[model samples]
Structure formats: structure tokens, C-alpha cells
Target: MKIEIWSDVMCPFCYIGKNNFEQALEKLPFKNEVEIEWKSFQLDPTLDASKPQSTIEYFKEKKGFPAEQASQMIAQVAQMGKGAGIDFNFEKALVINTFAAHKLLHLAKKHGKSSEMEEALFKAHFTDGKNVGDVEELISLAEKTGIDNDEARRALTSDEFNYEINQDIQEAKNNGISSVPFFVLNGKYAVSGAQPAEVFADALQQTYKETASPFKDLSQNGGASCDTDGCSI
Candidate 1:
């Protein structure tokens, strides 16, 4: 089974959703058979990457939220992060354009390290408060995912994988996904938001059941066999 996740690195609930999804998968019998592909979705595609601002400040200024309200909202998200086993430090997080980071994710996908790359990017932005939009920082994160330094640098320096990034964004739009942390299971079932582990597990189970083999043999021991020219009982 294939699971496509549409999320942005800067989205707090995306990280939490990823954690909850993984927790659900860990207890499933067909965990190894599931393939997870992280798709890019930018919450603020026009944000200036060169001038990153504090996440709280961005919420206050851009969203028209008061200082106290912004802090309260962030605190609520941080509490949710804790429930998902994530240490979200929104105070230190910066609101920067993730276009370059998304491009690098496509590059990592080529090396079969997209999942690892996604995790690293989330941690860098939400936990470690690193500048994910920076090429050098992204290269360092890519290196940690087993991507070669030179290859990562080349990919980041050039427009490599930009098309793939745009394609993912367009696909998300085509699917009418207006939110982050959206999950599409087997391209058939859609689960939105950062739901609990039980929700994800139920979705996984239902999708698996629908996609699994339909045959169920009830014959005992050696029963009877029939062929074109011979029959045995």
C-alpha cells in the first residue's frame, strides 16, 4: 500500500501528524509493505526566504492576531506536539519560504531518502530552529539523510527538482487539499488534519482490507483436485 502525505516543514501539525501516523503503522502487521511518500505543500509560498521572521511575530502581523493570542495559539500547538512526542520550539522557529527545501526533498526522493529528509527538515525547523530555507543548512540536513554533500550542493545551487516541487504543489491543489497534514491512502482514502493514532490505524486497516487479496481458500487438507484430463478425490 502507498501513502502520500501532503505537508509543509514549517507546519507544526504536519510533524505531529507524521508522528501519529508512524505510531499507527508500527503496530500494523503490514507495516513493511507500506510505502510513504512525502509531498510538498507550501503554506506561504510567497514568503521571503531571505528575510525570515519569528513565527509568533508572523502570526501576529500577518494573521492579525494579538501578541497574547498568538502566543496562546502557539502554546496550544506546542502542547499538541508534546502529545505526539515532538519538542516544538515555536519561539525559536522562523517563518521562511520552503520552496528550496521542497526542491531538495525531490532530490532526496531520487536517492530513496525522502522520508528521512522530511523528518530532518521538520526537526530542523520546529525543534532545532534552523533556517530550512538556507541552501547550506539544507545541504547539511540532506547529508544527514545519506545524500552526498556535492550532490546536495549541486541540487540546491541549481534549479534541479524545482519542477517536481511545483508538480507536488499543483497536485495538492488539484486534489482540493487546502490544508496541511493531509493524508491520501492508496489514492483512495483521504484523511485530513493531525488526527489521533487510532484514526490513522483505522484508516490503514480499512484501506488494507479493500486492497488486499480477495481470495479465501476453505478447502481441507488435500480435498479434491480436478484437471483437464484427470480428477482425484
Candidate 2:
């Protein structure tokens, strides 16, 4: 079974959702049989990478949230994250373009380290308050995930995985997805949101059970066959 997750590095719910999904996979019996693919999705593709802004400021100035209500909204998300074992310091998170980080993810995928890269990026932005849009910051995080630093820099400087990122976005559009942390199981079942662990566990169990096929033995046993007995003497 395959699980594809479309998420943004700066999205708080994406971090929480990742925790929930990981917990679910841990409890699932068929967890070893499942492969997780992290797909790219930018919550703010047009965000200016030159200037940095705090989440509260971005919400109030860019998204038009009232100054007073921004913290409240972020607090609600933080509280929700607590339940999923994520310490989301959204107050310090930066509002910047995630395209470069997404490209690094594509590189990580080729090296079988996509999940590690994803976790590092999320923690870098939401927990440690690192600028994920910055190539140096991204390279540092990539190094921690066992990615080659020089190659990572190359990927960031050049136009690598640009089409891969766009394809993921186009696929999201085709699937009618407009949210971060969106999940698709076997390309058939969809789960959208930072749901609880049990919800994800149930989906995994149900999908694995439903897709299982019955065993069949259609081979012939020759002219004569017997179990621990002589035949056709």
C-alpha cells in the first residue's frame, strides 16, 4: 500500500498531521507494508522570500486578520498540536516561499530520505523558527537529513524539480484538494485534515483489508498425487 501526503512545511496542521499519521502507522499491523510519499504543496507560493515576517504579522497584514484575533487563532492551533505531541511555536514561524524547500524534498525522495527531510523542514520552520525559504537554512537542514550539502545547494540554485513541484500542485487541483496535510491512500481513499491517530489507524486498517485479495492455487498436481502415500504402484 502507498500513502501520499500533500503538505506545506510552514503549515502547523501539516506538522500535527504528520505526527498523527506516524502514530497511526506505528499502531497498524500492516505498517511495514505501507510506503509513504511526501508530495509538495506550497501554502503561499507568492510569498516574498526577500523580506521575512512573523506569522501573526502575516495573518494580520496579508490575510486581513484583526491584530488582536491573530494570536488567538494561532493559540488554538498550538493547543490542538499539544494533543498530537507537537510543540508548534507559530508566533516565531516565518512567512516565506516554500518552493525551494519543496525542491529539496524532491531530492531527498530520490535518496530515500524524504520523510526525514519533511520532518526536519517542519521542525525548522515551526519549532526552531528557521527561515526555510533561505537556501543556506535549507542546506543546513538537508545536511542533517543525510543529504549531500553541495548537491542540495546545486538543486536549490538550479531549476531542479520545478516541474515536479508543479505536477504535485496540478495533481492536487485535479483531486479537488485545496488544503495542506491532505492524505491519499492507494489513490482511492482520501483523508483531509489533522485528524486524530485513531482515525488514521482505522483508514489504514480498512484500506489494507479492502485491497487484500484471496489466495488462489490454480496449478495441477500431475497425474497422481498423494500426501505421504504411494500412488499408482
Candidate 3:
């Protein structure tokens, strides 16, 4: 089965969702057979990638929420992350345009290090407070995560693999997805939001069962074809 996830790097819930989904996958009976694909969906694509604003400030300005409210919200998210065995340091978070980050993720996929790169980028932004939007910083982090520095530098500097990033975003929108952490199973079943592990597990199980059987080919049976009437028996 193929599980495609649409997520943004800056989304707090996305990081949590990634952990939650991984936990659920670990418990699945067919976990070994599952293939996961990470897709890009930027929450805010218009923001400048060079600016180094804190996440708190970004939230405050965008949502017009007071500092205390923002802090409380972040604290709640942090608690949730802890439950999933992930650390979230919202205070140290930076507001970044994740376009290049997502592009690099696609590049990492080719080298079989997409997941590692994804987790590293999240940690760099949310935990270590590194500037993920910067090419130099990203290259350094990539090198630390088993990606070759020369390859990383080339990928970052060139526009190669950019179309894949845009294609992911466009595909998500075509599927009526307006949020991050969206999961699509087998190109048929979709579950939105950072749902609990049990919920995801149940859905995956059900979808697997639903498509487990094979049906006879209508063409082999040569059933009556009706195009104009749109009916067959």
C-alpha cells in the first residue's frame, strides 16, 4: 500500500501527526509492505524565506493573538508532542518559507533518505531553532543526516527538483486538501487532520480489507454495454 502525506514543516500539528502516524504504522500487520511518500503543502507560501522571525511573533501577527494565548496554544501542542515521543520547542521555532525545504525533501527521496531529512528539518526548525529556510543551514543539516554536502549544495543552489515540489502542492489542492498532515491511502481513502493513532490504524485496516478481494473483469463477461442509455444489466 502507498501512503502519501501532505504536510508543512512549520505546522506544529504536522510534526505531531508524523509521529502519530509512524506509531500507528509500526502496529500494523503489513507494516513491512507499506510504502510512504511525503508531499508538500505550504501553510503560508508567500512569506519571505530569508527573514528570521520567531514562530511566536509570526503567530501573533498573523492571527492577532496575544502573547499569552500563543504561548498557551504552543504549550498544549508541546504536551501533545511529548505524548508522541517528540519534542517541540515553540519558543525557539522560526517562521520559514518551506518551499526549498520541501524541494530538498524530494531530492532526498531519490537518495533513500527522505524520512531522515524530513525529521531532521523538523528538528532543526522546531527543536534546535535552526534557520531551515537558509540554504547554507539546510546543507549543513543535510550533511549531518547522511546526505553528501556536495550533493546537498548542488540541489539547493540549482532549480532542479523544484517542479516536484510544486506538483505535490498542486496535487494536494486538486484532491480538495486545504490543510497539512493529510493522509491518502492507496489513492482511494483519505483521512484529514492529526487524528489519533487508533483512528488511523482502524481506517487503514478498513481500507485494506475493502480492497483485499478481486472481482471478475466485466470485459471478460462481455456484459451489455450501454453508452447513450448509461445502463447495463
CA lDDT of each prediction against the hidden true structure: 0.91, 0.90, 0.86
Rank candidates by lDDT, best first: 1, 2, 3
- On residues 75-100, what C-alpha lDDT tens digit does candidate 1 reach at each position? 99999999999999998897899998
Candidate topping lDDT? 1
Q: Show where candidate 3 strays beyond 4 Å.
A: 214-233
Check candidate 2 and list the clashing pairs.
Answer: none
Q: Could you list the CA RMSD of all candidates, in the order they appear?
A: 3.7, 4.6, 5.7
lDDT of 2 at 94: 88
Candidate 2's displacement at residue 99, Å, is 0.4
Candidate 3, residues 152-231, lDDT tens digits: the string is 88888888988888899889878899988899998988988888899889988877776675354657577767888697
What does the lDDT come to for candidate 2?
0.90
- By lDDT, the better pick of 1 and 2 is 1
Task: Count steric clashes of candidate 1.
Answer: 0
| TM-score to native of every candidate shown | 0.91, 0.90, 0.89
